[model samples]
Target chain A: MTATTDQTATAATSAKLSPYKRFTPTRGNFELWSWVFMRASGILLLVLVFGHLFVNLMLGEGIHAIDFAFVAGKWSSPFWQVWDMLMLWLGMLHGFNGVRTIINDYTEREGTRWVLKTLLVVATVFTIVLGTLVIFTFDPCIDPNSTLSVCTK
Target chain B: MTATATQPSSDEQKAGAVPTFTVTLKVQRYNPEVDEAPHFETYEVTAHATDRVLDALHQIKWEQDGSLTFRRSCAHGVCGSDAMRINGKNRLACKTLIKDVNPDKPITVEPIKGLPLEKDLVVDMEPFFDAYREIQPFLITNGHEPTRERIQSQADRDRFDDTTKCILCAACTTSCPVFWNDGQYFGPAAIVNAHRFIFDSRDDGGSQRLEILNDKEGVWRCRTTFNCTDACPRGIQVTKAIQEVKRALLTSRF
Candidate 1:
C-alpha cells in the first residue's frame, strides 16, 4: 500500500542496500552450512539420545544396573563406543550452534558477542576432545594387568 | 500567498507556545540514471515541536526543492506507506514527532534496510510481497463449505488478534538482520501473516501453513532478535508469533 508520492522523472532509487546497524553475516556458506548442520544433527541426535536412554534406563535391569562396571561393560565393545562417540559429538555441536544463535540475537554489543562465541568454541572443542579420548581409550578392566572380568585373556 | 500570523517567528517561544526550531535533515539521495552510488543531501526545515517528520519532508519538497522525492499518503500512520528510516530506526514518519527525537542535531532519513532501495524513501517491495504470497496467507477450508457463515468463538479470535493487525508495511521484515543478510528467509512479516491464519479457529489451513513454515528458511530462521517487534507499527509480537509457528510445526498441532 505504498503511495507513489512526489515522483521525479530523472531520479531513481538504488538497487543496493548497504548494511546499517547490523553485523555482517558470517562470511561464505557458514550460515547455510550451520543451518543444514542443525537440521541434520537434530534428527540424528533424536535417535541417538533416545536409543541411549532406552538402553541405559529401559533395557536389562534398567536404571539400577547402571554403574562404573556397567559403563565399562558398554565401552568394552567398539560398537557401543562408536555409538556413544557419535552421540557425544553430534549433541555438543548441535547445542553449541543453538547457543551461538542465541548469543547473536541477544548480545547488542559486538565485543561481548565475539567473546561469548569464542568461549563457546573453546568449550565445545575441549568437551569433544576430552569425550572422544575417554571413549576410545577407556579400560574396561580396572586393573591393567588383570586377565579376569571384562579384560582380555 | 499569505504568511501565517500565529506561527512562532523565533526559537525563544515558551513550552506552551509553538516552539519553532530549525531541523537539519540528511536524506539519502540516489538517482540510478545519474549517480553510481547513493549520497546524503542536507536540507534545513523550520518546524514546530509538534510537527511530525512527514511535515518536514513536505516542507523540503514544496519549498526548498520540488525534486525531493518520497512516498506518503493519508499523512497518517494507517496507510503504512510512509515508513522510512528515521535517524536509523524504521518508523512511520507521520507517527514520529520532531521533539520525540533529539532534534537538536541533524536527523538522518533513509529508506528502510534490507530491501533494494529504488529511490529516496522507497524500496522495491516486490520481493517482500513475493514472500508474503508464497505463504498463501488466506483462509483455507478443505471440507464442504458451510452454507452458513462459519462460526468462531471469542477466544479463537483473541488468540490471533495481535497478528491480525499487521498492515503489511514491511517494517518488521526490513528491520530484521536475518532478512538483511539473506533474502531467502521467509522474513517476520510472512511468518506473522501465516500465524494470523494458522491460529484462527475458522481457518483450515493451519497444517498447510505449518508444513510450509517447517522448511529451513521458515520460522527457524528467526533468532529472536526482537527488532521486528520493535519496528512494527502495530506492536505485533513478531518474534513470539514466529515461535508459535515453530511450536506448531514441532508438535504438528495448531
Candidate 2:
C-alpha cells in the first residue's frame, strides 16, 4: 500500500453530493476491452455508415431510385456485399455493447440486468444471423418466380 | 465530558429557532498499530437542521474524543479533504446537511472507497495522486511566451471552463466504482483534470495528454457510469469531459 500525505491541511476542502453505489470487479480487463471497442467501432462505424448512407441517399437519382432493384443491384457485387456485411456486424455489435453499458449503469437489481442483457443478446444474435444470411445468401435470381430484370439476368 | 456543542457560524445560525435534536454519528475507527479491523464508534451530538455532518465530527473530536482522527482542513467545501462515505454515500461532510439525510437513523460515516483506509476517515491518496501525475496535469507550452501575456479568446477559455473548477479532492475519483475495482484506471478526477488542458486552445500539450489517456487503463477504461459526475464536489460534467477526451483521441488520428 502506498503511503498517504497531507498538503496544506489549513486550506479549505471541497464537498459534494453522494454518488450511487456499485459493485467493483475484483478481476479482469473487461472494462478495458469495452472501452477500446467503443473507440474502434466508433471510428469504423463513421466510415462504414457514412459510406452506406451516401450510396443510398446521395448517389444518382437519390432515394427515388431505391427499390428491390437498387438493393439487388448493389448486393450482387462482391465489394458491396463485403461493405454491407461489415456495416451490419460492426453496427449491431457497437449498438448492443453501448446498450449493455446503459443496462449495467441504470439497472440496480440483478434481475433487471440479467433479463435485459439476455434479451439484448438474443435480439443482437437474431439480427446478426438474419442480416448476414440476407446479405450473403440473398440472390434475386434464385427466386425463380421473380420477373425483375436482375432476377432474370 | 457531556459538552454542549458550540453554535454554528452566524451565517448558518437559524433565526428564531432552538437547536435541540441529537444526531448519532456512527464513525468507523481503526488503528493499524493495534486493531485488526476497523470498528464503529457512535457519538450522539447536539445539533440542528442547519448543522452539517462535519460539525458533529468536530464535536466528537473536540469534547468527546480527541483521539478520533479524520482529515479536514477547510471546514467549508473548498479543500476536498473531508470526503467520506457519510451514511453510505460519498460526500464532503462539510457540505452535507444533517437534515438532508434522515436524521432519525444513525448516520454511518466511513472512509472513501478505492483507497486504503489508514485510520478513521483518512485513506492513502498516493495512488490517486500517482494517476493524476501520470496524466501530466499541467499546461505544456511549446510556443514562446508573449511579452505581455499569451493571448486567448474568451470562447477558447470557456470551452474548458467547467473542468477548470476541479479542486482535486478525489471525491469524484474515489466515488468511481471503476477505480474502486481497478486502481489502474484513470478515474474521473484525473480525466477531468486532463480535459481542462486538453480542450484549451492555448495549450500545445493536448496531443501528449491524448496519447497518454489512450492507454488501456486510460480514458477507455471509463464506463460512463456517472458515479464520478454525481460525486463531483464542484459539479463538473465529469462524464461529459471524459467523452470529450475520447472524441479528441478518435479524431486526433484523422
Candidate 3:
C-alpha cells in the first residue's frame, strides 16, 4: 500500500531513517571527554584563578605592589612560572571551549561557523602562546643599568 | 462586547451565579493556501473564570469563526493534545483556566514552536515522533519473552517514575530554545522518553539507547536552560533527566 497522506511529505518525512548502530568505545568520545574536562578543569581553575588574583591584587602590598620588578621576581621562580602557565592554559582553553559551544549554539550556517571557529582558534592560540612565552621567557635583567639583585648577578 | 456588560460582579457570584467576563483571544492564524506568513486574529468570547483556554477556543471556533483550527482530543489534559503557547508559555489549553492566565489583557494563543506548522495552532508532529522512535522507546530485553510476565520491583519502577509521566505533548521539546535554533538536535521529549526506558532495570538496551543519545545532536545539545522542565505539563524534570543520561554516559552506569 502507498504511504501517502493529505499533505505533502517533507524531506524529513519521506526519507527512511537508517538503522541505529550502537556506538562502540573504539570510537572517539570527544564531546563526552570535553564535557568531563570542562567540569574537572573548572574546579582546578577556581583555585588557580583565585590564587593568582589574591597574590596580585590583594596580597602583602595589594595592587600598587604590582610593578615590573614584582612580575619579574615571581616569574623568576619555577613554581610561580608553572603556576602562571597552568592558569593561562586552563583559563584560555576553558574560555575557548565555552565560546566554541556558543558559536555552535547560535550560528546556523556552516560557512559562518567555520569562519567564527577559525578566528576563535587563532585568537586562543595567539593568547596562550604569547602568555606562556611571557611566563617562561620573562627576563629580570632587561634594563641595562638595573640595580635589582637578579640584574646585578 | 464590553467587559462590564456580561461580567457578573462579586454580589452576583455570591448569589450562586457563575462570574463571566469578555475574554479576547489573540490567536495566531496561518493557512499556507492563503496566507504567506502567520498572523494574529482576535476574537472576543464571554467566558467564566473557571473556563479553560480550550473553552475559549471552542467558543471562538463554534460561535465566532468556523475556520479557527486547533487540536484537542480528550479536552482534559490526559490525551496530551491541545498543547499550545498561551501568553508566550507552552501549556495545555485544557489545563489552564481563564483567570489563571491574566485575562485583563488579550491572551495570546499560538502553536508550539520548533515544529513545522501545519495550520492554525497545529504543527506537523512527524519529526517529533521520529526522534521518539529513534530512541526505541519500548522495553527491550536481551532474551526471548518468558511465559510469565517479566517481574519488576517497586523500587526499580520508582527509579524512572518521573519520566514515565510524559504525554508526548511536544510542550517540553518546543519550549527549548536550542531545539528552536536547531531542529536536527533530538528535542527534550525524545530524550525524556529515552530516559524513561534507559533507567528501566528490566530493559537490557540502556547502553544502546545511551549510545544513540551520545550523538552530537543528542543530549550534548541540551544547554540546560530548564525551559523543558518548566514547560512540562506533567511536571517531569526534563533537564534533570537529560543530565542523568549525560552522567550515565560518562560513568557508563545506569
Candidate 4:
C-alpha cells in the first residue's frame, strides 16, 4: 500500500508538469482573452444595451419619436453619429467574441478552425464596412443633378 | 503464525470476496400511441460497485423485465445511440458508469429534452436528421477530380478528423437551447460536419457552403451555451467549430 501510494503521488506530480512543458501558448491566450472579454463586454453591454433601449423606448416621445425623418434628423448630429457608431462597434465585437469563444470550444480540427475563422472575419468586415458607409454617407434629400443633398438644398 | 490457526471454519472465507450492494433504477416509461402520460417504473438490480448505468439497464432487461425498451449499440461508447438524460445532463449511457454517478441512490433515466417522444427512452430522430441533411453535408469540388486520389497532405486530412467523430447521436444538437426554439437554425452537428469539408484543402465547396450558411437563421442563431460540448460523447469541441464557421463567414467577401 505504501509503495502504491508513493507511485501515485509521483505520477500525479509528473502529470501536472507535463502539460506546461509540451504545449506552447499560441492561440490559447486569445481564448483566455476572449473569456475575460465576455464578462467585461457583458458589463459594458448591460450599459450600452440599456442606454440604447432607454433612448429608443423611454426618452421624450419614446416609440413615437422613431421614423425615417427621425433617423435622418439624428444622423445629422455628430453626437448621435458617435453614439450609434460606438453601439455598432461594441455590439458587433461582443457578439463576435461570444461566437469566437463558442468556436474554440467546439471546432477541433485546425483546418476547420482556419476556414471558419476566415469566414467570420469576412462577414464581420463586410457588415461593418457597409454599415459604416451607410452611416457616414447619407443622402436624405437627393437632387438629380447635385452630388451632395445638403449642397443641393 | 500456524496454518491451523489461519484456517477458517467456512469454505466461503477461502474465496476472495468483497461487500455487495443492491441498486434501484427509476426509468421513465411512455407509449405515445397508447399511454395517457409518462410514468416511472422502478427495477431493483444487484450490481458490482464498478458497473456502469448501461450495465444495470442490461441486467434489468435480461433478468427482471424483458419488455423494457431502449436503444444501445457499440456498448463501449463509440456509437452515440445510447445518449439520454442521465440525472438532467446529456450523457452516453454506455460511457457513464454507475460508480461515477450516485451508486448509493436509485438512478433516474429519461429521454433527451426538447425532442418529440416516439416512445420511452426514444425520441423522433427525423428532425435531427433533416437538419443534418439540409447543410449539404457531402463534398462538392468545383474542379474535376484527379485520376489518382485527389492529393492532400497528412496535415490537411487532420483538419477534419475531429468533426468526423460525430456519430449523428443528436446529443450536441438536442442539448442546444437555440435548436430547441428554432428548428431552422443549423444545429451544432451539421455545422461541425460542414466545417469538415469547408476546410478540406482538396474540396472546392467553401464559397457555396458559406452562401448556404449565411442566412439570418444560420450560424448567427447560435447562443454559445456550451451545453453541446459537455454532452458530446466523443468530446468533439462543438462551440469552437461554430465560431470557426462564423469567422469564415466574417472574412469572406461578398
Cα deviation of B11, candidate 1, in Å: 14
Tell me the tens digit of each residue's lDDT in model 1 across A1-110.
13344243222332233222113332233554576689899999999999999999999999999987889889888899999999999999999999998776566566
> What is the fraction of true interface contacts found in candidate 3?
0.23
DockQ of 3: 0.29
**Tens-digit lDDT track for model 4 on B1-254?**
24324445465533344333688888988976589998999988887666778999999889987877889998888878888888777888988878777877878999887667767898867667766776788878775667897888999989877888888888898888766653445678878888888888887888777666665445766778899898898999999988888778767742
* TM-score of each predicted structure versus truth: 0.68, 0.65, 0.90, 0.62
Q: Candidate 2, residues A83-117: lDDT per residue as tens digits?
A: 99998998999999989876765665668889999
Model 2 spans > 4 angstroms off: A1-153, B1-17
Best by lDDT: 3
TM-score-better candidate, 1 vs 3: 3
lDDT, ranked from best to worst: 3, 1, 2, 4
By DockQ, who's the top model here? 3
Give the 10-residue window scoring lowest on summed lDDT in candidate 3 chain B. Answer: B7-16
User: Candidate 2 lDDT (Cα, whole model)?
Assistant: 0.81
Q: Residue B27: error of model 4 in Å?
A: 1.0
Candidate 2 second chain TM: 0.92
- Which is the better candidate, 1 or 2, if ranked by lDDT? 1
- Candidate 4: which stretches are off by over 4 Å? A1-153, B1-19
CAPRI-style class, candidate 3: acceptable
The list of candidate 3 runs beyond 4 A from truth reads A1-28, B1-15
DockQ values of all predictions: 0.07, 0.09, 0.29, 0.02
